[model samples]
Target: MLSIERTLLRLVMAALLIGAVSVSGTVYFATLEEFNEALDAELKHVATSLARYRDLSDASSAQRPAGTGRVAEPELEDSEIETFTRDAAGKLLYASDEKVRMPFIDSEGLTRVSVGGESWIVYTARHRVGYAQAAQRVDSRRAIARESATRILPPMLLLAMGIGGLLIYGLRLGLRPLDAAARDVAGRSARSLAPIDCTRLPAEITPMVQAINGLMARLDDSMTAQRRFLADAAHELRSPITALRLQLQLLDRSSDGAANAAARADLQQGVDRAQRLVEQLLQVARTEPEAQIAPMLPLDLGSIVREVVEAASAKAEAWQLDLGATLAEEVPVLGDRSQLLILLNNLVENALRHTPSGGVIDVGAEMRDGRPVLFVLDTGPGIPKAERERVFDRFYRGGQPARSGRAALGSGLGLAIVKAIAGQHGAVVELLDRVGEPGLEVRVSFPRR
Candidate 1:
């Protein structure tokens, strides 16, 4: 749950700390090694000088017991350096300081020895008379190493701290665009579904921003469609409900049997119109773009058209219209059967209602350009080219009057439902004037399998 800037800062600080520790450890060990080597060299040089003094005939005087024939301590820069000489009989002869006494060591070269319960690095050299030794305290060597580390560590720590601060500041500055994007989203109203700005965005975050923008665009479209459907439903339902109410009022006031019967019939007709309008409104809502379409399977377009024609036969007989279908082969297509049936029914019903008595309504399916094409050709007053587009809109009736005076039979949602269903199947629906005729040809061309 850590913020990006804090996470980056933590990683940078941890790296800096590790680097500081590594550098400090390297410097500490190197300084310690060099200091020890220099100390050992000084001890050896002093021991050699003292041995040479004894070889120059001072041995007889230097071989005496402790506190006798004392030699002046070497004029070394470090006062911690102590010098002494011992005889072959394991007794100290020459002493640079009277209080400094060390165990007699006959071995040569550098070695650690304890004097008065303190550790020192002693270097011994044998002469013709006795042994000469030079020693330095272990504690003094440790103190020098400590001073060296102190001198090197403070600057390293300060540099690491400064780098860490700068890294944190840089991380914060780099993430400012994300912070601004979040604030922009937070400040928007609930109704605001506009896409977020992607300009100046970092490449790493651009994909996320684009996805968010795409989701917002889809949401905006869905909400707009919902609002439009609701408004249209309310507007279309108002007229039938008002007419039904008036018819009911008239029936209630009528006392004559004939007048009561006529009012009752009028009321029934109004109720039927309202019920049909409600059904069509439900259909329109069901076909909204956001609604999930049923899965499509391979279906015979010709068979579907024939079935629709058979189903509408009774209505066609009542209207005295010839409703028949022609199949150019099986004419296979990929579609949802139930939805396709609804589509055909709506087309045929629209054609039958618009066509005059004795007019022919032919439903046909055939292959065109390696795809299935279904057409409903009606011998009726076809929709003009200008009004064809508007006819497919929800509850939109044509401006031209119906030849059969049966416009009221339709709720004006037939073509809208057709268009929606066609869209779901990825089909193209077009209304065109029938060739060499005054009728219309409505075609639904589906994609090639």
Candidate 2:
């Protein structure tokens, strides 16, 4: 629900508003201070001017008699400066207003005084004969300061509004690239796993776009692999189903009891081969996924080889093949237990299926060069050097495994499954011709812990 654009816009406006308020408040206070300073200076000037009249009165009294000359005053307006004079003996000599008397002080300086219950800024001057005081009402002086300071608000408000407009325009223009990137991503479909345009994108957004493109690329690959597996499974299963139908028809047409019995046995063999192929296909499907998600646990490769040999011993005996395992005490490996089990089972069964009667299939696991190694060797006609690599490819049963047996040669997924599981566990599988023997040795080497 949160929008980046809206949040940025709000923050920009909020800062602008706060700045405007702060500037306006500072201007208002500064203007008020200057206005009050001018008023105080005016009060001092008027009080100093009144000193000339007191000196004139002293001259007249000296020429004639004491307390004879009256101090002449200016005809001041009621809102203008109010004047008062007192002699050195604290006697009122003259007053500008008969009712509104300003308080007079002995010292000469600016002062604040309450006269007739109203505050005034009064300035007193010490003279040769008396003191002269000039005062102005505080409320009237403050009104002038407020009026002068308020003139700034209209222009400031207008400027603030204009800048806000510019801010909105700038924000819209700056965010256009982000909108374009969003649109580019929004237009894609499931079939289009192509990457986003990173060329013009901001540095902050480039990494996220790359991560999304990577995920989509992986998904596309997984889907493609699944499709290929389905196609291969359908192609391989069709042959067995058709053969089953043909075998059933032949068994129904046969009249002799012995011929019918033979047909039934062959049909059963076909069923077994189909069943094994389906099972191996399922294992192939399960193994070809991303291996990082698998629950790989530490296990002994020796134990895996021994367990697989024991399970396949009866099957090997039924086919007249000798099955056995030679294992070390501990050969540690990290791998999915079930998948590893399937991998070993496939290698052992592949040998059992291809090795002829009276042939020995030797399974072994041990540590070599600080790495765990599992190998299966059989005394059967081995794979050709050229075909060894291709044998591990899906659905590629090597060109007529030259062994005489009815244990079913293979559905071709055995070594392929083995290679896949080993690869998932970071192991390398090699199809090497047995030394001093006529057989193949499938050796799998796992990375050292």
Indicate which candidate wins on TM-score.
Answer: 2
TM-score of each: 0.64, 0.66
Provide the lowest-lDDT 10-residue window in model 2: 62-71
Let me know the TM-score candidate 2 reaches against the reference structure.
Answer: 0.66
lDDT of 2 by residue, 305-397 (tens): 878988988888887888888876788889888888898899888887778889999999998899889999999888888888898888887
Clashing pairs in 2: none
Task: Kindly report which residue stretches of model 2 are placed more than 4 angstroms away from their true locations once superposed.
Answer: 14-213, 290-294, 399-408, 433-438
Clashing pairs in 1: none
What is the lDDT of every predicted structure here? Answer: 0.85, 0.79
In candidate 2 the C-alpha lDDT for residue 276 amounts to 89
Q: Write the per-residue lDDT of candidate 1 for residues 216-242, one digit (tens) a residue.
A: 788888888789878888988888899
User: Over the full model, what C-alpha lDDT does candidate 2 score relative to the true structure?
Assistant: 0.79
In model 2, the Cα lDDT at residue 251 comes to: 99
